[model samples]
Target: MSNDHGDEPHELRVSKIRSGTVIDHVRGGQALNVLAILGIDGSEGEEVSIGMNVPSDRLARKDIVKVEGRELSQDEVDVLSLIAPDATINIVRDYEVVEKHRVERPDIVEGVLSCPNRNCITTGDEPVTSGFEVLEEAVRCSYCGTIVREEIASLIDTA
Candidate 1:
């Protein structure tokens, strides 16, 4: 079925992966962030493909990331939820989608984000891991109660 744009029917521009994860419907402009979260530098010998600002019926514009020969860990997916909550994860094997689901924001996020508060224990030399309560518009530090509402990309602890 052709759309009103008269453009050719949308197709997967990237080749299918033998086995890996395909993150689709990512918020437009956030595909690079997803790649960052995945720690894929494109130098690790894995086939990685990214499509940004792609057309989407649900989001109008979206991004997609295809990683060949690897699957995302739960921690990685959790971090993704913070950046692209509405994104869908597709587990592809043998060029077929075996599993598909949308990413969900967990009630508690840990270790992935550094508390913005300087005095927060997470920032201190102590061994406390950062913890936050997932809120609708912000994440509240469980230690210092500091609410992080913006610039989440900067606050993410990729270590």
Candidate 2:
């Protein structure tokens, strides 16, 4: 079946995790940001595999992240939606996909992201946690009313 067409059907195989999570359909070039959101810096011995700017049918280009030995929390997945709204989270167990779901935006996010406003109350010495109300495409600081619409993942404080 050697045809003259330059295009040919193909498939890529990424290793499967025995137990953990696989985040698929991430917006291309945001794989590093996804790692940051999950607090993985390579210093904590997190087993991670990433494929960026890969060919996709659902998107022009997409990224995939496979994290070993860990399942994401609801709060973590909520923040993920801020960047990769179309991502599909797959929970693997015993080399099988035990569960799969899409990330949903949360109404509020607390104690996860750092407010950029230096004068905001959450940045002060007072014992107050950061809070933000999730918007349609952004997040509004609950304390200082600062709206963040760009580089949302840069405000992530996984520490």
Candidate 3:
């Protein structure tokens, strides 16, 4: 609480990342979405921090996610792009960002990355593995064998 009205200073909470990945420029309100999509919740004892609506030159207002002691796998990166497509992945070591990568579309997607169709086999009792083929700019579900056009394929936002 500052007594000065117009010139009051704001407190900023920032933590240091000793190692692992620092995902920046996540779309506003989607950092946790990216985390859930990446299956970080299932990682027992793994430390993770998420910041939403932070200031950024690239995104203006954006979300950021920092994962400690773990590196994102290729599959995880693909999942991230599906949710927060414009995010940047930064690899940090010794408190320095050693590598950076912009999210890119993957050639194909496998397993139950997303529910193919509400009535598809993968969503039924059989628990069949789902697959998809990346078309020019879309991913087609191979189970029901339906093409999930890019525009319509974005409905699978949940983890």
TM-score of every prediction relative to native? 0.89, 0.92, 0.73
Candidate 3: tens digits of C-alpha lDDT, residues 12-116: 545878999988888787876776676666558778888888776678889988888888888778756766678899999998998999988777767636654
Output the worst ten-in-a-row residue range by lDDT, candidate 3: 150-159
- Please provide the root mean square deviation of candidate 1 (C-alpha atoms, Å): 2.3
**How accurate locally is residue 6 in candidate 1, as Cα lDDT from 0 to 100?**
93
Sorted by TM-score (best first), the order is: 2, 1, 3
Can you rank all candidates by lDDT, best first? 2, 1, 3
Quick one: best lDDT, which candidate?
2
Predictions in order: lDDT = 0.87, 0.92, 0.73
Instruction: Give the number of the best model, judged by TM-score.
Output: 2
After superposition, candidate 3 runs with Cα above 4 Å error: 1-13, 116-118, 125-127, 133-139, 145-159
Off by over 4 Å in 2: 1-9
Whole-model alpha-carbon lDDT for candidate 2:
0.92
Give a tens-digit lDDT track for model 2, residues 17-135: 89999999999999999999999999989889898999888889999999999999999998999999999999999989999999989899999999999999998899888999999
